[model samples]
Target: MITEFGLSELWEPETRRDPHAFYARVRAAGRPVPQVDPAGNRFWVVARHADVLEGLRHPEIGHQLPGLSHGEGEAERIASRQLISLDPPDHTRLRGLVGRAFTARMTARLEPWIAEVADRLVARARELGSFDGVADLADPLPVNVIAQLVGVPEDDRAMFRAWSATIVSASDWDGSATLAFAAYLDDLAALRRRAPADDLLSELVALEAGGDALDRDELVAMIQLLLIAGQETTVDVIVNGIRLLLTHPEQWRNLRDDPSLADAVVEETLRFRGPVEIVPPRFAFRDLDLAGGVIPAHERVALSLWGANRDPEVFADPDVFDVHRSDVRRHIAFGHGIHFCLGASLGRLEARIMFDRVARELGTLRLAADQGDFRLHHGGLPLTL
Candidate 1:
């Protein structure tokens, strides 16, 4: 039997810095822990690898659940615009269409451009001898790449960055953040309709141009969802991946010495500390037996990607950051099943380009400061990169 614990206590600075230890304690509790968030919504957080996969595979669960929320009373507000907050035929239809535009072939086609962009960024960073990984490399690379991919003009990328940051705030979506982003997206969607271009927005607009296409509201919501979903997580992956490699000199040396190891290096990074600590909340639609317990219908469940990836049952050491781990490919960072992240290919390509350039250009890169306790930003690492 597992002793229940408080969710708020788990959010403390010490826990945030070393959350894996917290996961261990929760796992040792023997079963999935049932808890309520600060907002009073009840949910089960599965902290062990086997349990997490079981929870993920349960058919009764969904991306959006009644009473499941981003934070506080913001469920209604978040649900209003993001496709992630929906389910079934509605979710499938929207996702299917967007998937057509963000296909693996399309994303892979952007690789050369991604490499060119990474080369430019590294050249600029090299001139300074050392630079912040997030600001110099992570933040700009994906933001610019996705911005261009989505058709936001070069000049408006600053606004895209600001809007993306606000929408993904780790805490809550309230006050000015809500109003400003809503207005910005509303206006931007209108602009895309008026002046189409060779970007994702234009494709969406063209879809809307046809009479039986996405409605105005769905179009706006989809745009907001794609922009935030596509950019923020990739930024963390690149920044955190770079931080992980630098901290582990052996891994860094391996990547630098052999350029072909870039792909494995990225997979290892995702396995080690890929961004997004928790997968989006999933709600149980019906009572389901998963790993010996019955999760009641209508209850909420969350799978900890961080915990599952570090699970000893699956990976050998589970804690050490090893690029050469044979089981690195098993990480569930991009999730599994039907709702797997649509942008995984693009995100992978982006990471590959960034790593390839880093290895080729910045030979023997080192962190300017000794790595400190990584504070969670947007619910993931904000290691000063």
Candidate 2:
């Protein structure tokens, strides 16, 4: 029995720095590992590769439950009402409206601009000779791109970036960032309602299907979701990829020799050192068998993507970071099913651009800090580049 406290024992700092050791312990434990808090509050963590995949796609699992919430009233509703927390018809309808906004055309149009952003960011990093990749390059790149896409005023982007960063770093316990972002989104949505423009926020504002449109609250939640989800994860992906390449010199060499390997590097990094430590806890819609462990209805269950991705059963020699690994793309870092990340393509494109730019600017990238000196950025995601 992995006590709830034991399974959740990894602190923010330690987990952020190196969670592999911790994950190994959990993986060695029985399926649907039990995690008990001091108060006897327990949750199940699914770490096996097969179980993680099943949990991700299972119809009996979802983000919603009647009484399961972090807090009472409006805050919980705001948190749950967002696309990430929705289920069924609501999820389907909202996904379609938002999906249309991020069409291939929009992505293509954003590519050159994204490349340009990467170039400028790289130049700035190069000028500094040495800089925190997460802060100087990886951090600002996606926020800027998303800002432009949402039509944020040039002068306000700095503030926009700050809020986005704060929210990403803020955990569920700290509701400040969430509240701050919600307030900001409320105002932005109002602006869009009055004067729609060519940007994504405006596009979403005007979007309608079958005579249905996103309500004010829904609009606010979607924009907040996009800014955080669209920008936050990609930052870690790029930062993690660069650091991995530098650490794995051979893989770095492969990428440097053939920049086309950037795509492979992105996929491998997402699998090996994924952005999220675990998928947001999904609730068991009802009693279900998972890895021989039965999860009770409405119980909170989390899938450790980091552990699952490295499951030996799924990937041979899973510990080795290889860009050329034939089965590298099979990792569920971006998730596996209906709730699979909507921003996956955008993230991959951003990471590819980041790697290509790094190779172009810094021929032989080297870590400025000791391997142990790095801190995790997006909740237990180690950051060093």
All models: lDDT? Answer: 0.74, 0.78
Q: Largest TM-score belongs to which candidate?
A: 2
1-385 in candidate 1: lDDT tens per residue? 4475766656667777788887777677766667677788777767777887777766678866666544543334544545566677777788877776666766766788888888889888888766677777777888888887877778888987887787677443354554555566667768878877667867776776565466655665676666777788788778777778888888889888887788888888787787767777777888866644666888777678888888888899988988788898889888877667878888888888888888898875876666565433333322222
Which regions of candidate 2 deviate over 4 angstroms?
A: 1-18, 28-30, 37-40, 69-74, 171-180, 208-210, 373-375, 378-385
lDDT tens digits, residues 1-385, model 2?
5434355565546664667766666677666776664565667878888888888888889877877654675556566678878888889988888888877777778999999999998888778777777878888888888888887887888877777767666554556666766687778777887988778887787765346678766776777777888788898888788888888888888888888888999999988888887887678989989976798888878788998889888898999999999998779988877778888888899999999888877775677765543334542222223
Best by lDDT: 2
Error of model 2, residue 199, in angstroms: 1.5
The deviation in Å at residue 334 for candidate 2 is 0.9
